[model samples]
Target: MSGTILDRILEKKKDEVRKLKEQFDAGNESKFQKIPFYDSFIHADKMNIIAEVKRASPSKGNINLDVNPAKQAKHYEASGANAISVLTDEPFFKGTLADLKAVRDVVGLPILCKDFIIDPIQIDAAKQAGANVILLIAAALDDEKLKSLYEYAYRQDLEVLLEVHNEEEMERALVLNPSVIGVNNRNLKTFEVDLGVTERLLSRFGKNHDRIFISESGIKTAKDVERVQKAGAKAILVGETLMLADDIQLTMNQLKVRLR
Candidate 1:
């Protein structure tokens, strides 16, 4: 990706997050209070494929840009998804917290308010936007900020899923000790994907970690899901693959049944 694209994407996200915070503080957002992500697979009787409702990305532009959240969310619920992940960042992803609220009103499942969370204000905004979980990227924060944010999310009864891309990021996530630790297959710097990233992390520390382990990114088929399932991850976070499908519900149901 060009530096221009990356810069523009991040700048747009910053402005969008700022407005989300403002709107949240104004008391005009949905606050759905149910922690379905904790025992998600048990509740659904299948491994999770957290379906994401997103439009664009820095890597791939204008995907599902005109999709309706409320309608799509109903499909996801019907398809046997344990939880829904809404990309709340607007600049690059063409997403918003408003979309999250719309999904919440249309579905009963938990929603993970996916964004570049950097402050407590954003956490408050996520809660207001009806999120049961929040993702904290390991590379985006230091030790002190990570601990503080994790504790804050825990205090608010939100499931914190710390995303780690490599060994050092995994070490940082371990320090925060979130309820869930996600092994992302995409490299942050270059945006290249390799499912081997999950394997390497699981090989070294998967057995030792006390929290729930989730494999994220680079999963495009049932075989990929099965590959990570044996590595001890009961859940996976998939976005682009699911979003671009003709029938997202069918796709999610297939993933859940195959993984089960």
Candidate 2:
């Protein structure tokens, strides 16, 4: 809260990863199979929604503390979300691996374990938690660490959502030739949201961007969904709006926009 929000989160994440590693070391890793997160996008014609089950965020505070993650995930699947993103960060996001496991048990859709992942241990933790995919933020990792983690996740048969905020980060992310690329409209350090960030970065890829392009953060209305789709985003990772809605499924239906 004092320094940059991202810095604080990363500091906490380092400690969290250490403890998680210890926990995994003590317990046996779950025998899990990777679900197809990217395949759904490839087979789908219209824009896809990767609805997130996030309880809280450092930027937005507590959005919905009492909601059951498993129930919410089933609702998202029924509402036509292509995939589910579960926040596994406990301190700021108010989530845990238990939330991911619960959702995984209920939803047939692919589950993405959304966290500030910095270590290879967390990737193992994600697989153990039933994540078909794991988020890798470009800004948090150096080139070596980024490539190392990306390869490590692939070896475990987990797809990666390489998230980037700016041109430089995008360049680094592209180097890995990631299966999925997320253009985050929100700045992790400052917590500022801008829908145009997705547009500007994705514009460089034009209409034929080969990788699955996902616009993350700051998406609220149907118009917001339409704008990003027009900008060449194949998918949208939405959280806060749906989480605070009067009816989560109804809100998702209203936000659904088709492109093609």
Candidate 3:
């Protein structure tokens, strides 16, 4: 699996981070601070939506290829989305930090810079781009790097959504005592989606699990949202469905009806 699509993506990320460090000065980081991501979900009172702005993906290419991230973010905010998730990977996802900045200039909602973050440079990049939250995939980093990156983001005043794809990864994520834990139902290697993956992992945690549980990926309808919430997820990160909807707000309402 060393030459797998995920592996190649990670290799490219490392090279990009190195080049970014050469060009970016850490002292020149953005002065724009942000609210805590956990607070957004807490105040939402229902299953919060982390509406995603993505143009393409490795699994399903060219989704909304002509996306206007700023415009889409405005629509998501108008539709009562609790937060926004901006894809920042350029090669596979056709996303850039520019997209995050564009949305940041327009919306007050918390924005998550979704990417395969392996190095601290990417964390700094996310901060400089006005991202309030950063995604740290457990499968992508070792225990030491995961802890280091988690603390690095915190030091930069950015919140983290530690993503775990399985029980083993969840165990590693819990070691850091993260404030938020997202169960990603999509397999990174095979790109196979199974919504039950979130439910199964969430069930392992009792009511006392203090971390905010977010179900990510494979969520399609109100019923899907309802299913995850029933399984104990406090939030859901939705992408393609809302992105492809003819009426974004209407689709949001449809998915949120379960909460009401």
Candidate 4:
């Protein structure tokens, strides 16, 4: 509350991490197989969709508060989504690890634990809950923490989606050389969104076949998909638009433009 949204979220995450450490049981293994998250985008001919099961966010108060995580994930899988991203931060996003477990139980597709991860304990918890991938936001962590967490997730056999919003964050993220990199259009600090954020970052770095590029947030239409696709985004992570869609399958299909 004293700082920006990102700062406030990170502060809150510290408390969550402490609680996670208190109750997390590392010996408990996930029942699901660790699906390859990055490879899905690399092999796809069309724009890969990491369809998100997000109930709410700091920016949008409540999108779909009553959505059943398992049922929603099934819809995404049936609609050709490459992966499923489950927002697991309960305080801000109104999502919990239980939602992730529910989605994992129902979908064969790789599941991404979309949370502001600052500690290794969160990664352990995600793995225990059956997440195949975890998000590492550049804005939420410094250089040291970023590298350590990125390495830790790999050691846990979990994929890391290193997310960046600007040129500086992108520079920091590149040092890790993560297999999958996402250009988030939403500024975590301000909560403002712009699809141009993806275009600018990709334009600056150009395309790297070795690293799967994903454009996250603010993508709603085929035109929005094409805009980022032209800028060399191989995949996209969509949340609110799909959550509010009257027809989930049709909305997903519309956003999944063929990769150029």
lDDT of 3: 0.89
* lDDT tens readout by residue for model 3, 1-260: 48677898999998888888898878876967676789757655667899999999998899998999999999999999989999999999999999999999999999999999999889988999999999999989999999999999999889999999899999999888887999999988788999999889988862544568999999989899988888888889999999989999888887774442
Write the candidate numbers in order of decreasing TM-score. Answer: 4, 3, 2, 1
Query: What tens-digit string does per-residue lDDT give for candidate 1 at 1-260?
Result: 34654345555656766765665554554456676686765333456778889888767778888989888878887877778899988766888878998998888887899887878888888887789999887776788888898899888778888999899988887766556888988876677888888888888878853457888988888778888877767788888888888887667766773433
**Candidates in descending lDDT order:** 4, 3, 2, 1
Candidate 4 contains a number of clashing pairs equal to: 0
| Candidate 2 Cα deviation (angstroms), residue 197 | 0.3
Q: In model 3, where do residues sit more than 4 Å from their true spots?
A: 257-260
The superposed Cα distance between candidate 4 and the true structure at residue 85, in angstroms, equals 0.2
How many clashes in each structure? 0, 0, 0, 0
Task: Provide TM-scores for the models.
Answer: 0.89, 0.95, 0.96, 0.98
lDDT, candidate 4, equals 0.91
User: Which of 1 and 4 is ahead in TM-score?
Assistant: 4
TM value for model 1? 0.89
For residues 123-179, could you state the per-residue lDDT of candidate 2 as single tens digits?
988888889999999988999999999999999889999999999999888887776
Q: Assess each prediction's global lDDT (C-alpha) against the native.
A: 0.79, 0.88, 0.89, 0.91
